[model samples]
Target chain A: MNKHKQVVLDRNKVLSQIQRLAEVAKTDNWQYEYDAQLDELVYGKDFMPRDSFLFNVNGEINLFISPDSSVSGIHIEYFQANYLAHNQELQPALRAITKKTIKNQRDNEAATALEIELSADAFKSLFSKDQLITVL
Target chain B: MPEQEHILKCRDCEGKLVIFHRHNYDIHKKKHPELEDTAFFPDRVRNALKYPTFTIPGNGNSVTCYYVEEFSINGIIKYTKVVLMNKPYIMANEKIHHIMTAHKVGHVQEEKYPGLKKQMYHNGNKI
Candidate 1:
């Protein structure tokens, strides 16, 4: 006869990972910004806590997962020159937003969302990596 | 008591470095308990700014990222500190160069952003 030890799993950790995946999948009402100075793009929902661990998805892209087990945010460094500058459609749209054409902050946010919608292929290229490598 | 304004200055740019109680101090304490020791906290930050191992451009125009490597029982750990040229949260008319936050990035981050590795500098010399 063999005695087996009972195995217990961390429920909260599992739940948070699930929630982060769901949020990433949905991709709705995401607040985004393209910092022209740093040429970085960051977008996410909810507050990103201090305990968030960064998971590198690809060379220039990474995801932030909060301690609560939720996807806090994602950022793409060198957004303009690397990703958007080459593309004809995305280049102009992003330039317009950063150029301060949309004076209102709220309206600017809306414009950014619209630009992202138009450049789905461009943005998707950043997340083309299907495998999530644990860099942390 | 000395005001926060008189406490520190940015090593590279020579600008004043301000740490807010709410955004920086409290938040950092909660997130990075490893750096909670009051004795070495200020010295660590000051030295990090003075002699950073890596200096990456920040995510925003007004921000700058600094990384310093530390040796611990676990091994070489890197701490990242971000400073902003303008504190948007503050309602003050004057621009404030604020120390936003500091946290450990571990060794893995160096592997993740290879481009940043190429730009690493030690004591103002490229390593």
Candidate 2:
């Protein structure tokens, strides 16, 4: 009997394994919600943050910073009419992402009340290089 | 559970303030239950509002008030105890001032509101 067995890689199994890895990587994508009633756009990490306090950023935006000084979330009041309208370049992409997030939340029966998450690609495309630096 | 409320005499507006049982009963509890060691009791909150270090106006006549006590060494502020009124509630109502929630925060830059300090003086000390 041969002491060592020859290992064969199943091509389909390998492809599926790679796809699973890609999905796992998307889990860290940022989540957002445009609350119509509040007229605010809340963008942040998906989980409930440990006790955070609001730090007003230029009166319009509020950054929720944790005790550790990490920025947990961002809340932009009067989002569409004020914030987005003023920044015309950010409007199209933001609106599209918001719509898609809402639709996804409505479709997923198991989705919690937390803000809907953006897909990996959508999250990456949401902000330009400068915008990302400024916002963060 | 029986309803418990705290009737506070707001020093800011010099009016009656009410903290309903439901407002600070659960997560933002007045007294910490056996579950946790943290507490945001009413008395401390009321005291902070009465002698606030700084206040900033919010949208729609609301105010974000803070009662900060600083500890300095050699003219350098090393630590600060910050009691923040988290919600932008109606704090100016002479008839009845209803403040919503209050929480403690970490060190905050006093230079954030430069002009507001002129209006925020307590015990002859410029806040």
Candidate 3:
């Protein structure tokens, strides 16, 4: 075979090997942010224990927590609300009320403000993978 | 003790982010009837607040929760962005979320190296 033809064949063979390896790896993922992190910067710690009450879907409290409800060394009872509400269907308002409880705290103000700013940003987050839905 | 301030991290040099993990920090509490009894983790993010010149959906909705953290593991650093969304729950499209995550990581990278995002915006990721 001609030297030029031989070189072309070798290049083709190398390319074929690369293609096979690519299929084996099969991890072509676009880079984005991770999800576990939101809490790190926002809450600035792992989930802690706190005082909380479980409210109902109709906006009524299933049971009220004591005035001094926080228990030390717990996940900080942050908010015992619904995670599925963001999915759809009118949430009992418990989540909103619970969230309201945390809104604008002196310590959280900085984190909340940052989150609010990012929310308005033109760029998207890596963890916004979950499907978004509006409730009636 | 808990968190410091906010800064950026780079995805290229470092890696991905850890995200939303609230650990050791100064704690503050609230006990208002309206606000209820809630706790604060301080400026937990301490390092992810740059990327100024921001904007939200003109459609009229506010964000409730979000945070991104970049750290190293096994000599590889990664970026993570946690979002606890509320209103306007339904996003415009699917790929849009991925774009946003990439953008947030972009924010982390910009935070690490000043002017990176703006430079990328202008130069278009030549690297």
How close to the true structure is residue A58 of candidate 2, measured as C-alpha lDDT?
A: 46
Q: What DockQ values do the models have?
A: 0.12, 0.06, 0.04
Q: Each candidate's TM vs. the true structure?
A: 0.48, 0.42, 0.19
**TM-score: model 1, chain A:** 0.50
Task: Give the lDDT of residue A136 in candidate 2.
Answer: 11
Candidate 1, residue A58: how far the Cα is off, in Å: 0.5
lDDT of 3 by residue, A9-128 (tens): 122322232233223122321111112222111111122224332111111111112223211111111121222223233232233323434354543453333333322220132122
**Whole-model lDDT for model 3 versus the true structure?**
0.23
Residues A51-122, candidate 1: write the lDDT tens digits: 565443444555555434355556555576555644545554564455534676766565555444433532
lDDT of 3 at A67: 22
Tens digit of lDDT per residue, candidate 2, span A66-106? 43444445555556656556655555545554565546544
By descending lDDT, how would the candidates be arranged?
Answer: 1, 2, 3
